[model samples]
Target: MRSSDVSAGLAEGAGQAAAERIRDAAILRYGRDGFAVGLRAVGADAGVTAGLVLHYFGSKEGLRRACDAYVLSVIRSEKLKATTGGPAVVIAQLAEVEEYAPIALYALRSLQAGGELAIEFMEQMCADALEYLEAGVAQGLLKPSRDPVARARYLATQAMGSLLLWVSLHPEFHEIDDFRKELRQLWDEIALPALELFSEGLFVDRTMLDEYLMYVCDPPAGDAKP
Candidate 1:
C-alpha cells in the first residue's frame, strides 16, 4: 500500500481503539452512576474530550446503546462459558467476581432506571438465556425443558427480581464504597440458598406441580372455572 493509504488505515485502527475505550469507560461510569451521568463525565473517565465522545458515538444515547450491546455480549459470553465449562469453571469465575462487578452493576442500574431500555435489556437477556440453556441441555449439563423459552424467561425474571428485592431490602448495599465488595456480599448471602434450591429443589415431590398441571393448566373439559 502507499504511504497515505497506510496512514489512513492506522488512523482508522486508532479511532476504533479509542471508541472501544470510550465505550468501556462509559460502562464503568453508568454502572457506578446511572444513565443520567453526562457524556462529559464519561469522557473524563475515558481520558477523551466530550466532543470526541460525541464524534464517536453521535450522542449520549448512542453511547448508551453501545454500552448496552457490549454488556449483553459480555453476559452471553460468560453464561455460555458457564454452560460449557460446568461447575468447576463457574466456581473459578466466582472467585474472580470483581471482574464482573462493572457488568453486574450496569445491568442493575438499567433495571433500576426502569424504562424502554430496561425492558429491551431484559428481553435480550431472556433471549440469551434461552440460547445458553439450550446449549446446556445439549451438553447434558442441564435438563431439557418442556417449554424452554418460557423456562428461560422465568429464570431470567426470577434471578433479576430476586436481585432487585435483595438490593431494596439492604439499602446499605448501595452505600458501600466498593462495588465489588457490595456484589461479593450479595453473592455470599444468597449463594447457599440459591444453590440449594436450584440443586435440591424446594418441593419434596412433584405433587404440587402435578396438581397444578392437571387442575390449573389443563383441566378436564367440564372442570373449567367460570
Candidate 2:
C-alpha cells in the first residue's frame, strides 16, 4: 500500500480506538453518576482531549446515543441467539455479559431518569422484545398468548425491572462471579416459577373455568347463550 494510504489507515484505526475508549469511560462514569457527568470528565477519564471527544461524537448527547446503541446491539444479538430458549435464554445470555455490567447499569439509570431519549430507547427495546416473542411463537418455542403485544410489554417491563434490581444489589457482593451466580439463582427462583405458572396455566379445571367465564361475562353479541 502507498505510504499515504498506510497513514490514512493508521489514523482511522487510532480514531476508532479513541472513540471506543471514550465510550467505555462514559459508560463507567454514567453508571456511577448518570448524565450529570460532563463530556470533559469522560474525556479526562478516557485520557483523551475534550476536543477529540467532541470531534468523534459531536456532543454529550451524541456520545450517550452511541453508548445506548452499543449496549442495545450487544443485548439484541444475544437475545436473537437465545430465541429458542425463550426468556430463560435471554437471562442466561445476561450472565455472559457481566463484564459489561457498567453499561447495563448505565441503561437502567438512563431509563429511571426518563426523558425523550429514555422513552425512545425503552420503546425501541419493547418493540424488539415483541418481535422476539413473535419469533418464539413461530418457532414453536413459546406459547402464543391471546394478546402478544400485552405479553411483550409485561415481559419487557419485568426484564428491565429485574436488571435494575440486580444492579441495586450488585455492590453488596464482593466477587463478580458470586454476584452472577446469585443473580442466576434469583432468576431461577422468580422467573422459573412464573414460567411454570404460565405454562401450566391459571385454572385447575378448564371446564369449570369456561363455565364461570360464560356465566359471569356476556357471550358474543350475536351468539349469546340462550
Per TM-score, the best of the predicted structures is 1
Q: Taking the tens digit of each residue's C-alpha lDDT, what string does model 2 give over 63-93?
A: 9999888877766666656776766666666
Q: Backbone clash tally for model 2?
A: 0
Candidate of highest lDDT: 1
Please report, in order, the local distance difference test score of every candidate based on alpha carbons.
0.85, 0.76
The segments of candidate 1 whose C-alpha lies over 4 angstroms from its true place after superposition are: 171-177, 218-226
TM-score, candidate 2, is: 0.74
TM for every model, in the order presented, reads 0.90, 0.74
Per-prediction CA RMSD (Å): 4.6, 5.3
